[model samples]
Target: MDPVDYVFTVRTGDRKNAGTDANVKVILHGDGGRKTDKMKLRNILKNDFERSQIDNFTVKKQFKIRNIEKLELWRDNFGLGSAWYLDYVKVRRKDKDTEYSFPVFRWIPAKTHLIFRVNDTSLPQQDPEAEQRWNELKRKRDSYIVCQKITGGPAQVIKLYCSTSLKGQVPKRK
Candidate 1:
């Protein structure tokens, strides 16, 4: 396989304490079972992954991964303020004009791993990875339960509740 270059742009959320000092890594997954080894994201000269910052990283691999499907990202719980708030990631192959965007507007706790799939609006049944789709749906179904608080009332899905203190810590929308 010919070596290919890929550029990854990571955006940090513009919220209080949204940056992290821990080491971050990523793995790119593509079609036909193609994947890349975990690569570290770092900038030695300047502090990276700061709040509201967009950092770019270049990765060169011998294998040319076609049609990127997902990105696996994680951070090592090292140093102070390890939690991070990721806004999104954009990836583009050097020779390709098309760019892939993965939106992940959420907080990543210390030492946590998360998978961000491409923004394909396909239904679960239409997903190519049947096992993954099934597992994801099953997990969601198990985590949320339907309950009726009042008689003859509509049922609501009950999932994990956020603590008031935690909610207060979140920044209010402008």
Candidate 2:
């Protein structure tokens, strides 16, 4: 979470044509290249998915997710035919002493505390619908503090929770 080197936007809106939209919070914690993480975030966000935690009610400063989206990491350069992208995500929920998978995209992070946000752009190529959703996400998003390490040059390792949220949905993949 080093001031967010990058972000992936997943948005929606109140527009009649906006269709069905969901916002899921995904916890992306693991060691890999930037490409892997980015690709996962985008694919999952645009897919049907969910992230459920084991009801460990941690105090989150009195906030609620009006919308939840499971944002998997994705790549900036979706080159070739190797896009693993998001297929399906399942939220693990339990009731009556039984665990169930909810087909919701409020994807929770593997670990708690770490945070991220969807990338934003004002370029003309950006989708109009996505822009609107991004707007809504920014209007009602939340953040948390996590001890994450942002690696760079050997002596320039940065540490902090560069956490934020996205405000849109992924355009149908091209």
Candidate 3:
């Protein structure tokens, strides 16, 4: 199913810090113009609040994607206190039940955005150049096997040589 909207869930580690109060920006880029969503987090909880005394503070935002190829999430701290300790960012969709969780077990500085590529499994088939290259590589591999086995050698020695020498020659998949 096509994605209609994205729901982002973010949580801060420290409850006592003002890091939870933030302005987050989400940008979705696709064939059309980029779509932006601004999220606001208010300072309801003060610095004296204990972490275990209450539930963790989390912020959620839902933006309409319509159609997107990739997206970026950013926290615009605008010169605040210490960097925010991010636990994670989860992306969900309205049409699909699948949810993608991006684990960010680190501190997020101001003005930094995390970019993600949308994995569209239903992408249109491209030119046959990639297929042709694969076929050629397969034929070359079979020839290499035949030629190597034609000469008698220890199985373990041949295996070691072939494995090490072919490491750099493998093709990368797109």
Q: Tell how far residue 141 is off in model 3, in angstroms.
A: 44
How accurate locally is residue 136 in candidate 3, as Cα lDDT from 0 to 100?
Answer: 41
Write model 1 residue lDDT over 37-133, tens digit each, in one string. Answer: 8888887787889999999988877357889999888898887888898999998999898899988787775555667789744666676656755
Residue pairs that clash (backbone atoms under 3 angstroms), model 3: none
- Highest lDDT among the candidates is held by which one? 1
**Top model number, TM-score:** 1
TM-score of 3: 0.40
- Candidate 3, residues 1-174, lDDT tens digits: the string is 232545555555654453533455556554566554554433365441122222222334444455555556566654445446665555566566666555544455467666544542222245223453355456445534322322353322223335555454442221
- Can you tell me which runs of candidate 1 are displaced by over 4 Å? 120-174
| Clashes per candidate (backbone, < 3 Å) | 0, 40, 0
Candidate 2 local lDDT, 100-148, one digit each (tens)? 1222122222222222222222343554446544643553343322222
Lowest-sum lDDT 10-residue window in model 3: 48-57
Listed in order, each prediction's TM-score against the native is: 0.69, 0.17, 0.40
- Cα deviation of 146 in candidate 2 (Å)? 49
lDDT of 3 at 146: 23
Q: List the lowest-lDDT window of 10 residues for candidate 1.
A: 165-174
